[model samples]
Target chain A: MSTSPTARRGNAVGDAWVIARRSLKHIRRQPEMLTDATIQPIMFVLLFAYVFGGAISVPQGGSYKEFLLGGIFAQTIVFGCFGIAIGLATDRSTGAIDRFRTLPIARSAVLTGRALAAVLIGLLPIILMSAAGLVVGWRTHTGVLDVLGGYALMVLFQFAMTWVGILMGSLLSTPQAVQGVAFTVLFPITFLASTFVPVDTLPGVLRTFAEWNPTTSLSGALRAQFGNPDVVAGTSDAWPLQHPVLYTVIWALTIIAICAPLAVRAFNRATGD
Target chain B: MAIEATGLVKRFGDMTAVAGVDLAVKAGSVTAVLGPNGAGKTTMVRMLTTLSQPDTGTITVAGFDVVADPTEVRRRIGYAAQDATVDELLTGRENLIMIGELHHLGRVRAKERAAVLLTQFSLDDAAERVVGKYSGGMRRRLDLAATLVATPEVLFLDEPTTGLDPRARNELWEVLDTLVDSGVTILLTTQYLEEAERLADHILVVDHGRIIASGSARELKRRIGGEQIRAVLRDRSRADDALRLISEATGGEAAFDADADAVVVATAGGAAAVAAVAGALAEAGIEVDELALRAATLDEVFLELTGHSADAAIEEPV
Candidate 1:
């Protein structure tokens, strides 16, 4: 890596940490903001896993609670990306970022910091959702290290989605626009993916999109690593459970590669006092 | 020169906000950009402070290019924009401390600077409170304090006294005077004629994206054609007689404005002309209410150069 700073190279990680730390302080100051992030996912997990657990069953799977957690974890992460979009839009409308533009700090630090903060906030929902999933009968067959590894990958998936959220936030004119656009994009992106069912059971068109979808890849990878029995990306000549980790990694990188630069350029165009 | 610009231009698509212009501001002096609404005063200041880019121009502040070396330029200058760009959630001390950190100051130094500025701006009493809870004057003062955290070589103040009360305006003027006395170069923009007159060492009169005149306040006022003799009327009927005598005495145009209830006499110098006019009025047995003479004000120069009536029936949209 080049030591010299490029226009694109900011202390993104450091700035992200500062913003994320500030967010933690904000959460502490106003605990009500924590309610949505820390409790919403758990409520959804409990509501779905118990209310609909009996009806959602696969032919070869046992204890639908075990399979539900992976799917919901994926859904929670994708849903949590909206926080980043809302935060960025708020900052833009208020000209907070505009003030940063006149400072000597690298230009990319503003969005990068906001995006990282979003993902850190995202962790609360993921953890609460996982615990709620376990209460409904989740039993991971993996060791402690594998559990950590699996959770880390999920975090990375959310982090990648954060960059996309920041891009949307920067492009949108207002916070209300962010909410509308997030709903429009996330509804289709989550529903078409294999969040609730196995890919083999869906119709051909839906199943094809589900199999290729990045969210499906992320959920599939986490489930396979946890020793869940519903994996079907393998053929007769291959292992019983196929690995989607590589595909998940690729998708995360690809989204960030497209999003990070676009966000910087869009941010540079905003006007302020 | 602390700042230099040659052919600075900023175009917003089809509309040119700042036409090509040249300017030089000496270090340790206060220069003001004076203009009415939409005269591009804010745009010119933004370009000079490196907050916005000029479409085509060469500009430098503190010997750094505003276009190519904006970061270096930003390091040497502190800019407080027309709108207060303050984070309301943060405390006053936090706002200033955060800015100090962004400037790469050590923690001890950042805290020290924040402490000093808070006291200097009389914001130390409210330093720990959130900005969202601050009053307008407090917020403005805290914003100014945050900008001063780095003690920059040059300062850019855009409409610093707008939205402030008379007391707050006077307080802010004193603060600016203090900063100016410490050898900091300042470039401020405002539509407040009295503000420019009070604080500016040199004033640049801008209209329609161009500088119409630039000089010391007295020089610009003196350049606005000569003296103005003004007097309030004891009765409306005496206006015609006063106008006739003043025109004959000064050998210049004399007019009485009914709305202003005052007579205007043009002459070489306003003080002597006022004396001469007063003596002539006494000899004619004309009674007067009030009379005085001084150099032309920014209001008069603005109306004359922009060709806008001071009391015309034009309603201001803002």
Candidate 2:
């Protein structure tokens, strides 16, 4: 039997925090979430910055170093989202969440804790990758405050996207389903934008999609903050800078708004011993 | 009330897993739900624990409406699923402590309760070991400990000892008995008749999503029809003679146990028939070794109600 939302466990924030602490404990013991979170972002930064950066030339005399860090930063945190989906799916399959359904703690604790931990985990990778990028000749012309804000902004994007992945995981039938869904959703979302290539170079149709894509907005705004050289282009290029960080925040909010409730609904339906 | 449900109904698509059923479990009693697999015993336990919802029933657990006040019900009740659920990465102590936290116990209280429960369940030795490394019995005990960390007023244990070795099963029984003695109302489901016979103050036999029988162990056992007498003869030659006398006394078929050197017969007149059989055996000069009269066990009661032999009830198609 389902109670109304008001009838669920005590305060959602209070419950979410308790859940977050428990999740942090789980992460500490397994250590894999931390390792994966750390390793994933590094791989994204290294693979793209060195291998493909040379071919993608910008009119601003793009030093592959200056050109790639912002996009790679976005990739680093976004990649961390997969861990959220996989972890949640694993917990569901193992009956952990089923057991939680009978507990008095807040109902949102399970997913919220996971999403929050993924954000914390993403922070480690962001720092590690940023350090690694700096060592690799990557440049960010933004001031100290801008750098800190940009990093914090990246973590928030990871947090929002983690919930999206969690929504997918909680709703899917299996972990393998999460794998397929995560890739099918994430790969296109990350790639159709300018993660590796400049968006302007693509065909008219794909270029329009890329320019409008949330991912490009995220990377573009970050790039703008870091003072990465930009080329003056058509109407689409202008949109990425109008509200520098607006697009990323809008995207993050949109995902959290839609997926958070869906996740809560899906998890609430998991009524079993 | 520990558990109160009216018109409890649960459905999964075309199939109704738990039909419209009513159940009430008084506080501080061990109520066993007995049934074969697919009989809704698990479903009923699930609903009582607030794990599943009946499509058309009102359920109040520990004085809170389950549909409208699940969090309160959960706070007051502890549930251990039929399948053991534990975090493999966490030690038994950690699992119990986490559950205590979920139940909103304070840090010190959670640890105190965890330590007490681990020792009570005889899982203290393995408290620090990861659950994935523990034996099935230990894991089951740990799961129970996790459920009990909050000292809930109601406890729901589903198929509590389904996969335990005999020694482990007995150990769990003692633990359960102690918990029940402490005034914890327990609602359990089990396919093991002996479990029900040993632990339940009241037994609920459910089948095909409905309650078929409900009573105390003694009352249910007495409903199995008649007393049984088993007589062991010294020689095979006396089997025919014994059969003749036993059939006349029992007014039914006489079953011979050649392996145990025994013949089991049922007699309606119980003690009088035993005296008559003893006299007939003495007159026939057939020495009997092991002559015993036994009341019906829960196994026998199960057979009588379900219409299957107690020994061969677990048959499956090849």
Candidate 3:
């Protein structure tokens, strides 16, 4: 039904920024909302560094605390998906998504904006963990460029994980369902990789799985970039472990390629007719 | 026409939520789609507003085809869903401004529009407060204000006052009346006959996904047997005598209301019918306890047109 002449449509990027700004405000209003990325990760760091670090030997004689930082970083970066999933689920259930769909802004702005917010949310964990790691006697011995590269990789991987979160959020019917399903899948995926322990110490099948896990590649890549333990490179014959950075990049890009379109499709199905 | 649709059909699995619906809403007129729950009123509104696609049919809103030029349709129309869809976490003013920004009003104009809407909806006092802290009525008003951020030409409301308290409902009705007076074409769906009677220039009764009847509220009531005069006799035995006397005096069909022990006559004669019935009863020495003329309610009209009460078990038509 025509009422007035059509107004100018907002550019997609600008619209996305507006939507992203709204999501980011939630974090500011409720600082406790950062518990997942901040307090929880810090707790894990303390628990691992003090309680478990002494017993678990680093693969290459490097400090376990230093080696542990890489795994924690990878795990937190990957779990950025859950934050995005929960946000999307809440939006869908609250009818906020329906409100957005009615606007004249670009439809792609909805998901892209959420992804942008997730990337920013992903930064909090990395920053907080770095401080927590320093307190626990963790340090990166690599050059400044390699250190920057490690953080950059974390952001790229976080970006890919956001799409997966969008997909899960769109497919899940409720926030409760998202929490249930996301944890069920993500918990084992993070644990099965080298996030908390040396992959060589696992059983035969589990070791093979961990060796090929994207989480492992990411952690190994971070270790290499930060000049931490080179255990995976020294002991593993696996192609991915040997070329951690390239392998992780391939995995991150692959996840983005596979999940982005499916996420968009699931999101459209959830919000559209 | 500001809004037009033909043969609109939407099916989920084997159940047809909306089947072969057609509509034409004139510009600057308030048309209420009156129906019970599960009558496809929301589905029809969704399709028209471009939130949902019809399996078959074409829709044109403000001269732009819904399917081919949905962005154009969206730019012209504003939709408020059955539930207040405002962001609870945002302040009342922030909600309107964000919607304005999405409407591409630009940040400065968006802020300007937000201020205007907040004051217009009497939400200025609560503008800085998060909507989560707002009362149900306040939230509803904020939701409506958000829709008006862009000065839409046509507005669609799906059960806008469904869950509001009486006072809040009346306040919302007043707001809608003002909008109509300012010439914003509106299409609203409601189960309340009073709401339709008060706000709608024309009403369409929908049931099982099709338009069963459409007319002014007065005409619809008249269609289902107009104003009725009912007389309760002091003695139940006099019901038969009362029925005959009432029908003869009003020259209209009469029936015994066993539940009320009253004789009811359908008449278009209004006050004259009541007078005639009262005079005849008294002249015939018929003892009457009470006599009253009542217009047909939408519930009765719904029953008459659909062969079921408006409050009947909501059937999911297959």
Using DockQ, give the best candidate's number: 3
Preferred candidate (TM-score higher): 1 or 2: 2
Tens digit per residue, CA lDDT, model 3, A1-273: 343643466799999999999988776665556788789889989999998899989766879999899999999887779878988999999889988888887999999999999899789888999999999999998999999999999999999999999999999978899999988999888999988788888888999999999999899999899998856856779998898999999999999999999999999999886
Candidate 3, position B132, lDDT: 85
- Clashing residue pairs in candidate 3 are A1-B61, A1-B62, A2-B61, A2-B62
Question: Per-residue lDDT of B16-133 in model 2, one digit per residue for the tens?
Answer: 8898788888878899988777777777877777777778889988888987877788877778987788888888988887777666666677788889988988888898988889
What DockQ does each prediction reach against the true complex?
0.33, 0.45, 0.60
Candidate 2 lDDT over residue span A1-273, tens digit each: 322212223566766776677667777777666677576667767777778766667765767766677777776666666777777887888878878888887666777777777777667877887887887778788798887777767877887888777777778757788888778877887888776667777798888788777777777777777777553244344575456588788888888899888877776664343
Best by TM-score: 3
Please estimate how well model 1 matches the true structure, expressed as its whole-model Cα lDDT.
0.76
True contacts kept of each: 0.33, 0.53, 0.67
Quote the chain B TM-score of every prediction.
0.85, 0.84, 0.86
Q: Taking the tens digit of each residue's C-alpha lDDT, what string does model 1 give over B93-171?
A: 8788777766666457778989999999899889999788988778778777777777777889888887788898888
